[model samples]
Target: MRRYTARLLGFLAVSAIAAFIGAGAYVYYGGYDTSALQQHSEPVYRVLQYVRERSILARSDFDTPDLTSLDWQHAGLMNYETYCRQCHGAPGRAPDSFSLGMKPAPTAIAELARKRSPQELYEVIEQGIKMTGMPAWAYRLNQAEMWQLVALVKQIANMTHADYDNYLVQAQEESPQQTETRPRRSEEIASATELPTMEGLSRIDAGRVAMQQYNCTSCHMIPGVTAARNQVGPPLGGITQRSYIAGLLEYSDNNLIKWIRFPTTVDKDTLMPDLGVSQVHAEAMLAYLKSVE
Candidate 1:
């Protein structure tokens, strides 16, 4: 028995050494493909797939909201055309050529939405994901605009090509020029200035005021929140209509509460600030936001 134990230990040690040496060789000799154009190996693909699935499962917890009566359909459509269509594609459109080269390429939201809850969808749009190409829009967008985008994503699964095109036209009409567009910095700064003084305002009005007070429009593209000239963040015409918040967090009242009161508490490294919002203000903000649809 003693001899057998010794032999087993020796074998384990040898295996460990051999595995490390092989991995070291692979790294040093550049054995793994580095080209972005190349498709991922089966193992790599499986790992990434698992990561995405697990991420969604763990982060998305809110109940799905009813999108039938949500009135931001046009806003959602416009935002999608300006911000999302290039990577996710529309009913008859293909993703841009550059998007194809991305590892774990951006999935068609139209297809992915079928498997997700609205809250989860909202999280992805608002917070985005780390180590992926997705960027956080919390600093850029206010709560209302975020929700509008959420509403639009909910309808992507059933959108027809003609419907998408019409939306594109509407978005163009909402904001005619592309290159010079972005939210204005001055508006955001002004919004922040008056945020402390506003009282008893509805969430929508509060959000609009907050956005303008903080100059949120300067960095983000919210249709009614700011002018058509500024679009640092993706367009947010119909965010309230979206199902997800940050492409991860489900759009729930509680989650939105947490997000507004303590953004970094949920994700420590998030770029969004706490913004010094009081609980009263947070509650009012959420109440106004929930009224979007």
Candidate 2:
């Protein structure tokens, strides 16, 4: 009886080893497909999806702030329009043609935001998912801005079609002029051509134009500018009066341009996003800021 049991154990161990070797050999010969365009088979998809979902659930630790305080819907909408809308799409808009070519196509994330937790949303935004075109903004946007983006996405999730359309229009129209307080005299009001009829704008005029165009006052309160008042970001009313930019960067012309164009490089958690400001725009904005101070 003992001899029979030993023989049976030996047969099982040999079979297991043979199975392991066969599987290794199959893998070594390139039996698996590795194409970005190919949709993962059911088994692969299920496993990957499970891992992604679980990892986000387990790793996400960001706190969801009071979205109302930021009134951040407009602040977020600008960047979303400039950056995310092309890939994730708006509530009523369709994604671009190239987004479809991806193996697992990007969804209209404004709708997807409804199904996700804020922490998970932040994780995805701050650190983009691998094997997809969704770029991370950890370097481009600060923590507060990231949360604001999340907040706007949450609103987008629950909006009706008309509400979305109106909201989008309103958000896009959130210009500095809306916050105008005292009446402006004809000469006091800055016009598109008030500075000079020259080819290039002076530094101060350039800065003023860029700030107004980008709606810098949406998050801050510049002394002379008409802008929505919010405590989310500080006022640059007398930026030159201060010694630093965003309380960290040195107060210099070169530094100001660098911050304007690539703030993420300056402060990883800055509320500012790289709106892809050109060298000319950055210089103009800097000139305006310096002149005002």
Candidate 3:
């Protein structure tokens, strides 16, 4: 019986190793459709769903603060309108046209809120789910602002279409010109505890601010910046140590500066866009990137 059991275990281990190697080879050979246009197969979706739920549930053990204030809800409304409404539509609204094309399309905020606790909502907001289009807002929003979003999500669960529309109108009236725009500096929306301006900061510090201002965190995993861990582009860490910039220009401060300021000029096919970095800002950013080692 002992020898029979040992043989069975050996067979099982070999089978598992073969399965893993086969899966890897399948992926390596491009047998899997990696397009965002294709939704996950049911088995894959179920596994991902299980992982997502378990991960959120395990990490979302913190206590949610008092979210009962009208002021807080209004703040939440503003944040929702600015950041979330386009993807996760409200009761009376449909998500923007582009969002519909996303595989595992953005879920209804109202329905999601009903299914999830405030703690879970806060966790998901602060730490975005992987393999999902959701981006972490921790770099852009303070703890209070994130909580405000949780409050808004909770309220969204209970609101009617007319109620949400009225809330938007009231929120707009309350803060007539306070909506945040993409091109605006991040400090404008930052909490009072944060530096109001980059004026007095060192060049390196200011460069870090400039990175956030230009929304570089949306793509690259930048050092010295929270929630800047997106893998859409190569990480900026140890960039100074690299032998080349974009594998075209030899590594040098001037070359890097040129790359930052006018990426398209150097390599037109690069996914990097010309963000129109000024000379001073480019130098400052180079200083910060140099310090990342």
lDDT of all predictions, in order shown?
0.65, 0.69, 0.80
Best by TM-score: 3
Q: Least accurate stretch of 10 residues (summed lDDT) in model 2?
A: 180-189
After TM-score superposition, the amount by which residue 37's alpha carbon in candidate 3 deviates from its true location, in angstroms, is: 3.0
Native-vs-model 2 lDDT? 0.69
Kindly list the per-residue Cα lDDT of model 1 for residues 1-293, writing each as its tens digit: 99999999999999999999999999999998878768889997888878976887787675545566554466566556557767888788998888877876888888766876777777787667765677555544555555677777777777888987777666667666642334433224323433323544556676665555445566667555545566554455555566876665787777776776677787787766666554545555555555544
On lDDT, the candidate that comes out on top is 3
Task: At residue 68, give the lDDT of candidate 2.
Answer: 71
Model 1 bad stretches (over 4 Å) = 63-71, 174-293
Give candidate 3's error at residue 87 in angstroms: 0.6
TM-score computed on alpha carbons, candidate 3: 0.67
